[model samples]
Target: MALQGPEELGEPVEESEDLDDQDASSISPAEEITLPPGPGGDEETEEALLLPWDRFSAWLHCICVVGFDLELGQAVEVRQKYPPGTKTSICYLSFPDSNSGCLGDTQFCFRFRQGSNRKTSLGCFLETTDRDAPPCLKQGHYYGYVYFRQVRDKSLKRGYFQKSLVLISQLPYVTFFHSLLKIMAPEYFEKQEPCLEAACNDIDRWPTPHPGRILTLPIMGVVLKVRIPTSYDKPGTSQLVQSAQRLTPLIVVSSPPPPPPPPRCFYPVFFHLQMLWELVLLGEALVVMAPSPAESSDTVLALVSCIAPLRYCSDFRPYFTIHDSEFKEYTTRTQAPPSVILGVTNPFFAKTLQHWPHIIRIGDMKQAGEMAKQMKVKKLKNLKTLDSKPGVYTAYKPYLNKDEEIIKQLQKGVQQKRPSAAQNAILRRYFLELTQSFIIPLERYVASLMPLQKSISPWKSPPQLRPFIQQDFMKTLEKAGPQLTSRLKGDWIGLYRHFLKSPNFDGWFRNRRKEMTQKLEALHLEALCEEDLQKRIQKHTEVETVDLVLKLKDKLTQAEREKLPVHPGTLEKLRAHIEGVILTLPEDLQGILHKPTTL
Candidate 1:
């Protein structure tokens, strides 16, 4: 497990922009705790040992936090009192370094405990209200013993106890410690303030495998390793053993040192990047964390084994495969996210993409100009492209209908050796392949992503952003761009790498307004292109129809010799073939052919 430290996370924490309207400064420093003068004159809660080295008087708090392995929206800790579920699991990170005593700076490693292998009863002190009712053990809770020994052979009978502990917030020890952190280091114990997904305003909109969110806790530590222990192996300095628990201390698996953790968020030693999903989709895992959020912060949260990976997919299987080492038995106690594993073909994922704020059309000026020309042909302007729908695999609907009467006039003029009606129909049916291939797809793509432009972004709109959020505010405050962004190129890849990594969090949001404007312009341009396409295809079709008319006239002379009527079958067959040639041309051409015209 490549545990992350503060230096590795490099992210300074910030409150959610969504909560900006709420009093963000509501957090006051934790109330002062008075330490009882004991043998060492140190303050120690019944649950946590105080660190005298730091003035903050921080407690070495060992918490029973459940990782939000599969939490859809809210933080998993909100379910702290509840039993673990699909998106929630028991993760152990604060291992007791026997050598470091209580407060010393010691290395940390993160491990996940495998869940119950079988349905077993948990025996606890439960009082039955009815005399006839029989005593029964709870089905899911884990019961275990925790040992505490005095650093020095001091008070309270050598200060050692093998106390049975229940992993429940309602339990005394659990409550005391939870209360201790709440009172002392209240920031961590306060409501879990996870940053929103890059595009979504809340967890309700979070999409799986969309982008890696930087999960940061208010506190900081380094992640050493992630392990799922199997057999009874005592910790480095204790005789503690277990049948199903894997919270062993300091189990190091040496590998060629992994690269430093990403600079976006400060991850505790317990959690690290499980998988770089984009690479996973491409069947690889290059775990060097880049693409920091446009927002500067030092913490990212994560859950392991809660959500399911896209099974049988080489791209996502690696996420399940990454564990401590071969020495330890790997565990898969929870399933991956349902929406993510459902496959890219899922309509929901495409819908999710629409909400994601950073889909870019990286086309340069030349491409934009070319697209513009398609939208509005100066000589042949007819209709706009924006009216049609967008897609590769999403909702798509056409916007225009071919003029049937015009086609009939053109076909009649040709058949009767007349020119005017034939000319009108030919001109109207132009851009045969362009509409089928380029126009509709471009329309679909734009329509699919239009939802992003309409989404309620946390960063204010440019007009709204001007008063409170200034562009490049960091330059005024820190004299440089965001640290992570500075390392990236100044283009779409850099901006797209992490939408939040834009110069200022607000700047990032406002920058998108420009793109949205361009997208709208493109939509209008598409409308123009649709019109131009019709005109151009009509011009081309005029030539083809004229040629066909000449051929028909030649056939007429031959028919005059053979005394055969103009072959209706041959004309119908030609009309059918031409009808299927382009996306919308068939209908117009067919109408022209099938309609009767007097010579």
Candidate 2:
């Protein structure tokens, strides 16, 4: 609602009661003007008097004076609209002083009283002895009038009334009788003079008192000052002075403190790692082939071995070539690993690795191998790696130069097989001898290497030697066996099909197959060690694998460019299959397989 201005508060009156005449009279102004006993007033005692006009003025002032209401909340603005009158209900008329001249600042607070049907606007006013007239007015005299109104639902309604009067023409009497007694009990009022004086002085210079005394009292707003004496000079007197000061006009009330803020949420590390792995898997494949002078051939080989495998797994197929000459030159110029070169040169790989940690470590090979074995036994026990198939082994098979000779030996062994009992005995004997001759020695060797291997910290040790040993030593043994045997056996058709179709097995049929297998084997062995080492190795493998995959990827690209349709399709299919296999692998393995780009 809009606020009303001073001009809108009340209407001006043409006439008022003759307060000036009543105030000017020297003789007893009314029948109620009875003088108290004094040394020279009267020789006999006089009856107490009652003056209707005087009582009316005093009552009007008490009700309508522009002063604070402790129970109600509002500011008082005193405005004299009419002079004092003889009318009992309407003697003097004045508005609450909006600007409490030299007293203190106040605010208008409106409250609706239940069942009273009245909306009251409460406030306070400051009276000053600094006025032009004497400190107080005489008894039976009227000074001013006041009327209060409240705003209710946008309408102004009259609430209360007050009329200023001079029952006594002294500042001390007017202040004490009208203000002090109304605000405080006589006892407290009498004792707090010094405190009130000090507070009044303190607020005299301020434009408006902040944290004013009236604020400490209910519905009173804030008081700036009060006139009182300062008679406190002794030590204990100061304490009493302070207590009295705080008791009324100099009251203090403090404000409350503010509240605290909310908490933050974040993604966990495992989830972050998973997202990174997925991104890396989506990037281009890389493979490193042996350097050669023929750029096209080298590119084709690398692509076939590396890029083709991952291309099938990821959505984006990247094909590029690094010629043997270029590779050699690059390597010679920068002594970093092939993987580092790939990571640096390829933006996709570099970006992916920015989120993934490097995991490759020395002990990873044995761990990886063991893990692979356990996984195979648990998930694919019926399958074989190679050399375990029937009709594939014989004494003359190794010496023979043709496939026909191996087939002949296998047929002869089957046809001339011993009677059932004799065959069983021979098998038992063979098993015993085989365990003693080969398995025991292999076990012993591994056992011997255990302590030295265990001593190596994955963090500080060099890359595991398992891949080189497996490829060079194991493969040599297989190749030089007494007979040429199939690497796989026993209902192996399904296993072979699965292995060949798997993304991990992509490009294995090519010359790069041996190298990839060796690398994979080494990684698998490493992962078989401690779980921590396995994790580290898997990370490393992902990086190296990505590099190798990308290198072969370039070859696949070259093949595609040369319009080698059959080779390109074959490479693409293999890449897809290998990628699928890699996805199926454990998280650690997958992490190893998928290397993100490095920064």
Candidate 3:
């Protein structure tokens, strides 16, 4: 069973055992008291006696505590003391070692006071096997402890009690001592600064102190002492003590290293070259215009020579020439005003005379002549001739007479050939009528049938009528009457005689002329009707061709719509087809098809 401490009881024992006791003791009358020897023989001396709070104080001070096993001969014997006439009850209190074992080396025994008289009460006893058993005692050790007590104030009518204790342990006396000093005596610790450096030096000089000689220091205004195992610097002392003294405390607070310098910004080399060129150009310009003649000449020559080398530099040449030309033109034109040059024999100084009239004395001829010579030698001319011959026109006369003769022959051949459609139609309609009906006279046809020629005599006519008579006619007429001959020779008589002789001819001519006029009118009507019918057929054919084209256009539009890929289900396939179509299309057409489509 575990042993209980005095704090659990309502009274204190009158008698208690010391380190010489080995058995239980009788109780006494006092409320708080120490103990004397019991029935057991005094096997352990006071030198080996461990204080009640030794292990506890050692742990509180962060000192290492040694552990032991109860089964391995590690145990503490305890005996309780209680008062007379008290129905005493024993309770065991056990404290576990730093090891995981169950209260192996630590134990306490308590005897509780009973009966109505509360003054005669309880007692406690504590002991360690380390004193009696060689295996239980740890070597090179320090210990600390805490004890709890319930004290009654008899002066008060009512009694109250609470727990209190003192703790003590061994620690390295160093700069860190202020922390432990504060815990021990906060008021005193606050009043005085701890001599940490001196104490640390002392600990370095003397690492181990004498054991069992408890060193007392105030703990919260109460005096307390703690025991520590002593270590020697001699040959047999453990190295663990030296290792602990040499241990260096680590500090973790540190500052971050400085950041790396900002990177440099580097512009490209071409930028430098460009700036250099510009500066050189500006310097050259300033040098050329410097006031001194020797200086200006030297500057101009240097600049020109410098630029001359760069003439083969493709890009530099054009730019330099442009700048040079512009500068020269500006300087020259500014120096010579146009108004001063109209009738001036020497235009070079005209501008200088007009603008800086006071400075332009006639004595500046040498400068003007030098300038003029420079201009003549260096100026670009406007009349730049081409390296090619002039163009010439060669004469070409056509023979008009031969052309006219050829045209006339062509016209004659056309007229002699078959007539054209219009000419044929006109001749068929009016040729016979015009030649016969219109040309023949109406009176001649009517008079030709009369017998005037027989009625007139051939010999009784005037002398002019004799020329009309042939020799055969006169011989035939020799036996005839003179009236017959005169009738034949007379003008009116000849017409009547001819009409009587050719009566059948007059009738046939008149009938043929009338028939020709009637046939011509009929042919004109037929030709006009045929032409009208041909025009109507041509118009109908044109209408048919127009209708066919319109139908073809409609069909083509329908086919295009059917082939369009607007349907929802075939979108993917349509896209592929469109890509193929684009590949097959001409570049111009493909540009149209590949254009972005809006939703």
Pick by lDDT: which candidate is best? 2
Please provide TM-scores, in order, for all candidate models, with all chains considered together. Answer: 0.17, 0.15, 0.12
Q: Which window of ten consecutive residues has the lowest lDDT sum in model 1?
A: 3-12
Task: List the candidate 3 regions with Cα displacement exceeding 4 Å.
Answer: 1-148, 153-158, 166-599
**Model 1 regions lying over 4 Å from their true place:** 1-79, 83-88, 93-599
Model 2 misplacement above 4 A: 1-37, 40-62, 65-141, 145-149, 152-245, 250-599
lDDT of 1: 0.23
Report the C-alpha lDDT of model 3 over 216-235, residue by residue, as the tens digit: 43333233233333221121
Q: Give the TM-score of candidate 2.
A: 0.15
Root mean square deviation (Cα) for candidate 2: 46.6
Quick one: ranking by lDDT, best first?
2, 3, 1
On the 0 to 100 scale, the lDDT of residue 591 in model 2 is 76
